[model samples]
Target: MKNNRYLLLVLLMAVIFFSGCERILDTEGISRITSFPTFQMQGEEIVTVVKGGTFTDPGVTTVEGYPVTSSITGSAYIVPGKTQPTDVVYTSGAVDTNVPGIYIITYSSTNPDGFSGTTTRTVFVLDQQPDPAVDLSGSYASGTSPGATITKVADGVFYSSNAWGGGSTVVIPAYLICTDGVNVNVPQQESTVRIFGHGTVAANGTLNLLMSRPTFGPPPLIDLVKDWVKAN
Candidate 1:
């Protein structure tokens, strides 16, 4: 009977002392904690990380924030909580920060009581490529149907009437200004400019045409005058 009572006291004391035993209380191997690592974020590509057998405590992850959907490169990371973090520190990796110009990265951590400390990593973001350039300042000319081709006429030869429905105007070097692939421009209101050879020649023979209002000039001229009449 006395031994039973004595055993009860010892067992009671044992319950109190063993209740605080750390190894018995610790279910996970703390030594197995993973160290947080850094990553390079690209513009907006998929980014990922692997844990070296460490379990993710549901409400805990890396300090970069939430588990990022691998499709969008963002400021996401597997942040270790107040507990020590573990995972091989990464180098030579890339991810997309998704910003237009440039960006940076740093490291930090959270505590068990919801507080945080920090370590750091860095990342760089770059710009996308630009479109190609084109040049179209040269010369081109279209005739009648707006699709008509004006043949280069020889000296003393006559050019036929085009969709303009009148006799052709001999294009002289002086009267010619510019010709886009579609339309043509000439010196403003030149009545009879000579079709000197392709270069600057003097006194080349010319073709004549009836000029209309705004003072009759040659045909094939783009008349830019707009005379607006207001009623009194």
Candidate 2:
């Protein structure tokens, strides 16, 4: 038992020595404390532009006192930073009003401390008004959600009250655009929830919708398909 105790003590000392050395080596990256700058949108995060109409960017600003690029210094706003930000790049996605699609604009800034911050905006370009004959505004009931309201803003534009099919801790509306009254799309938009999906409506007025959790890449964490029937 005396020999076993000595061996155990040696092993414990070795572990402690190695752990201390490892921590010392790992401190190289975190030797200096730094913080990433945050972004504040000047206008709405989601902008809707009418097809064939001119589109303009409302731009963004810095909230946590971050410097901005010189090009946008006059247009873009900033709070103020300890040091001017370097290597600032404002990349804006192309927006063609003649075509209907979603565009993304991104901005990135790096502070003198080598920390970087980035943000993006989403723009939707499509005709809000649809054919007068098309109307899908009604209460839809599905297995997961019951009595989800679909409010009509225009002939083709509708807002779904329950995008997650109910049971969500926070309820947010999702935009459903159906131009021809057959095909449907849930654009990537920010609300209490970020929604992205597509579905179709049958002749019998049955809605076959599929939704994915908010994600920046393919293969979302949560994928769900809900078939909603119009409540009589």
Candidate 3:
């Protein structure tokens, strides 16, 4: 009877010791990853530019950690002007210059171990004219007449509204090309008669337009000097 008790105790102790050893071995097999691949932006958080200006993409940097068995790959996407987060598309860092608003650029990177990271940057495209001296792009109001709107379509190129008080309500397309900081040459895109106009853009966003009409037999006749004040 005493031998049987001693054998039972020995078996129990062996089982306990083996269980303890197994626990320690399992713990030793597991490892805690202290570092991971991280993605970060290299430059300023906000990039500002005028409309029709080139945008330089400040790329991302990936910090590789231990166990670099795989390489890190990155992609960029743009959240279009004042759009929702779900409205994003992968891009090659090309931004639309026509749209003037806030754009969000998201960059993400992934590693072979399924570890990933992401960062974002903002780009602001302003509608304001780039040259401080030439502020010709804005809405203008002249007396009780229908207001005219002028917007910068490209660098130094502006689109202007049609003249008021015409029998036809059709809008005549007109474009102004700024040769100098103050001088502007208007070229009529479409018109039955040859139209010639010139203007000067003031510092306070005012336009002084001197238009000419076709004379039947002599030099072009000068029309009234129309002063357009920039609308608030």
Most TM-score-accurate candidate: 2
lDDT of 1 by residue, 1-232 (tens): 9999999999999988887685566855655554342333333221112212221111223544523222111222212221111121222223433432111233335444345443332222212221122111222232222221223332111122221212334332222211212112221122243111111111221212222222234342332221111111
Descending-lDDT candidate ranking: 2, 3, 1
- Off by more than 4 A, model 1: 1-3, 15-32, 41-232
Instruction: Give residue 77's error in model 1 in angstroms.
Output: 34
> Cα RMSD to native, each candidate?
31.3, 14.3, 17.8
Candidate 2, residues 146-188, lDDT tens digits: the string is: 4578887655667788766633444556777777788777655
Report how far off residue 184 is in candidate 1 (Å): 32
Shift in Å, residue 78, candidate 3: 18
What's the TM-score of every candidate structure? Answer: 0.17, 0.48, 0.40
Using lDDT as the yardstick, the better of models 1 and 3 is: 3
What's model 1's overall lDDT? 0.27
> TM-score order of candidates, best first?
2, 3, 1
Give one digit per residue, the lDDT tens place, for model 3 in 61-165: 777632322222211222223122223222333455565444556666667667666677655554456454443678876655567788765555566785421
